[model samples]
Target: MTPARVTGTPGRTRVLIVGGGITGLAAAHRLRERLGPDAEIIVAEQAMRLGGKIHTVDFAGRPVETGAESLLAARPEAIGLAEAVGLGDAIVYPSDAKPALSLGGELLDFPAGHMMGIPGDPADVAAIANAKERPDNGLPILEPGADMSVGALVRSRLGDEVLDRLVAPMLGGVYAGDVDRLSVRAVMPQLAAALERHARLTDAVNEIKRPPSDGPRKPVFATVDGGLERLVTATSASARAEIRLGMTVRELRQTPYGWEVIAGPVPDPIKIKADAVILAVPASPAAVLLRAVEPQAAAALSGVAYASVALAAFAFDRVDLPERSGFLTPASEGKTVKAATFASKKWPHLGRRRQIVRVSMGRLGEEALLQYDDPTLAKTALRELGEHLGMRLPDPVEQRVDRWGGALPQYTPGHDARIAAAREALGVHRNIAIAGAAVDGVGIAACIASGQRAADTIAATVVAADR
Candidate 1:
């Protein structure tokens, strides 16, 4: 383990960032830009490696993302950060090949005109799921600031078919959460806000679907040409912070001057002081660290649960595949594989090389599946993928499995309010900030935005104190 560069020296204009994942890295980079070159910044990560869930592998003839495959391009924070980090030319969009859904053991096109599988018109999804709307009670769908479960909202507005077949499969591929436990406000904010204004779900869908202008629509998703890991490395280099790898930040203390962080091993601890500190780790560690300083915030965060998931990447020499990009499977199908992304077909760069397919496995309450050995997990992914593809496949040229135990935070109903209350509790602090996947929505863009906000807050405080 590398020794921490900065010691517990107070009043150094130094900023300590906990966790070396994308969130922490982004915060550090933005801090350097705001605080100028002389300000000291450090990134401490428990793991030897960085990038958090965003991992890229050198597979076949190109680099592939085994964790988060793409960024939500519509969000500016991620794209803007990538461009700032000199990955503008490397940004690539997915091919026009649309993904399919496996329903009743058959691949079918996703319902047209829908918001995460809730169709604008019932007729559009009649072929897949029967949309049964509730009787109009002479009132709007939901009151202002009210919240409900995604399943309760969908099942009440549409039916279980739409919830189970369309929404669950599509949303599950991203969140790895059960629709019944997920929040409507947090997961579908735009639509949820629309619901407050309109009486029908169809009207809410149309409102969200309204085009910004007559201009051409931009790509919904994107990735770097080399891989997402490039974004991580480039951003860290640009930040120029003191990188502390394999170091766990165990405690945080608010002193008369600023703040003190106890990091490194349990036996031999390192106390590092800074003008301000930002926490960018997961919910569990974040809660544990905050328990001493802010109990109310920590209690709220402690209750937040997480879902474990795994991915298996395979590179085949040659094989016939469908014209589609990939397929998504609903949990109702009772299959281990929830979704499969045909990387070669989806990305134009990889299309020229081997047929690369990444299969996503596990969901809430399925953590035991990840306990299996690598070979067993890979074989299970292969078998389930074959079942989805409806064909026997030859041996893959290369295969790798990556497990993310409790990688994804499960946002339950009223999650937004709880997190807001938590933030409100900590808002009294001048030199402390919180940012992570649990702080806001999960995605490269959301995390980046959260980190930048934290950076801006810390920068403002430092400037004010100096003035």
Candidate 2:
């Protein structure tokens, strides 16, 4: 592993960014773009590569994202960043593949107008509504006061039959989190807001259906053309900042003049002096690193738990499955997969006939399924897909398992309080900052937003201190 170039004066105001992930890379790039000539910036990443959790592969004559597939179309940060980085032309639309729900080994069409089973219309609920079950199978807007788990919400809005048959497996496949433990408020606050305002979930949907004359705009999401890695690589090339890969920051200290970081080997660690620092690693590692700087903040950060996730991509010779682009399995139903994506069908670049499918397994507290080896994992995935597709498939010509011990963060109840406290704890210092997926959000766009915000903060602080 090559050490990061340690240049500049010992007491100079240089920004030291830890972690080479997208968030850290974005922070460094944004600092170079926004900061004045007087300020020096450097990024130190533990891995040899720059783009963390954003792996893209060119396989079967197409590009496939092994990590992050696409940004939420409704989120603006990713799109805006893409434009800023000169990647606007590469923007692609969300997956056009129709999502299906798998229930009791039976594939069922997802109910329309139902956003993650938070019913917005009585008519929509009627498709799966069970007359014998009161309020539970009733429409979202029809139920005045319903405070249930997403599982309960689904069962109530749809039916236990549908919940077991479809809804549970669908949601479980995505979050990998147990629906009961998962907080709808933290994960989907807009739906919660809709529920609060309309008294019935369906009423809020009805309101949203009508065109709004004027109001605070909603968020939008978009992805670049060559994949998100293009944004990362482009940002790295343009930053004008030094990047040190394969160098892990072992310790950080606040110096009388600025800040000091100890990185690389323990016997003789490389020392780096900087004006500011950004912790962009995963939540667990970031918490450990922040312990000495701010114990309380570390504790708060530690509280922001993460879930283990695994992804397996497979390619088949013939793609004849019905249009099941993406479907989820809710946690309540106790299914192996939380979700599956038909990559070939979802993206134009992936191509047809030669189908590339990506399947996600495990989430939050339920990760027992991830313990299987590659062959076992592949076989399990194939079996599940066969059951869902309603036919046996030819063995995949290409298959690989990507295991993420803690890929996704679970926003539990009181997440806001934990973050606020963590921020306040870090705020006690002058040249220390925290930015990553654990803070504001867990998506690619949110990570970029957090990094940019941290960069602005560091740039402002450095300029103010110089004055």
Candidate 3:
């Protein structure tokens, strides 16, 4: 966040954007294009720094992501934003190394031709899944517009082994959530759509997987060469908005002229008025701000829940690490560490100066794990990682642990309908919009697209009012 303040609030058109994460920053960047240079944009963030779930630290003389490591390269939003912000040259893709699953105290190859471990060909995953024989009863998996938990769908079609051994761990690694409660529609839209058209789960997954092509398959993930923080800072600079640090938006008031937000310290709050406002914070904070305005929207948003997670980064001088990129373990294994990434091996650009291993811990119901001290978390990560690799390892040259409490949104069933209802209720009011990972989808691309949509909505309304 920038410490500098604007000389004075603009008289022509002033827009206040709440939050300073990628979602909010993306909104401001698009708003600048929509409203032109005449409009004054103000970004109010509670934290002294931007990038909510995206952070990087200097460890072992190399920058590593303490939060999200890569962007969904297949999607254009994240990479598009990076290029728009002039960091196009820094985009790098992960190596072809595959990830393994720790099962039965052995490292097993991750199921292939699958969507989040839901294999298109049951035979391909039979080794890990051990799925019981189920007669395809000529029944379609899901009807159009219907929603269900991922676990229910997988369990019924593929069997308990697949759900517990493969799918659960695969989804948990990204969402920090249990498949039993996670919305299949929200997390795997492609598979959900395919389910509507196919009678078998295997057929549904087949539709979502890439078809055989003559050309080489492109990478699905990418990241900035140096660090992800550069993307955050660059987007903020590109927005050209007056960045305010350490200012919390207390209450939102709608005035006859426009909107007024009470922000800053409770004792001495500043009333910053704006022609329009964007509520782009997390679901909980966004709910608090919307309660006085639209309770229905608040009610819908309030229902959304979050999962906490911790990442422990270690740099070892020389130890026997596997040839694979990393490994993911299922919750059924009673493992404290859910996943580990061989950062240097995955992203070869990091080089072999020292082997960098990133381990992730905690799940949806394990918020207390984040309460543990950093040393404890790091120690547990190293111990579990060594056990998984079948080797007792030496001490790391350098190590760090980053705990992200309520970082990932656990989208329950009917998440789309809830968000749609919230947006519909908020639509009754003018000059107000909502965006973020909670309401939209999680991941860098989803948040960026969500913010862009909100900005476009508000910008169109603001412009129309002037006309």
lDDT of each: 0.89, 0.72, 0.89
Q: Which residue ranges in model 3 land beyond 4 Å of their true spot?
A: 1-10, 136-139
- Write model 2 residue lDDT over 177-228, tens digit each, in one string: 5665555555565665576665444565555553544985342434667777
TM-score of each: 0.97, 0.86, 0.97
The local distance difference test score of model 1 is 0.89
10 residues in a row with least lDDT, candidate 3: 1-10
Off by over 4 Å in 1: 1-11, 210-215
Clashes of each: 0, 31, 0
Q: On a 0 to 100 scale, what is the lDDT of residue 1 in model 3?
A: 26
Number of clashing pairs, model 3? 0
Clashing pairs in 3: none
Backbone clashes in model 1, listed as residue pairs: none
Off by over 4 Å in 2: 1-7, 10-12, 129-174, 192-198, 204-221, 332-334
The local lDDT score (0 to 100) that residue 195 gets in candidate 2 is 60
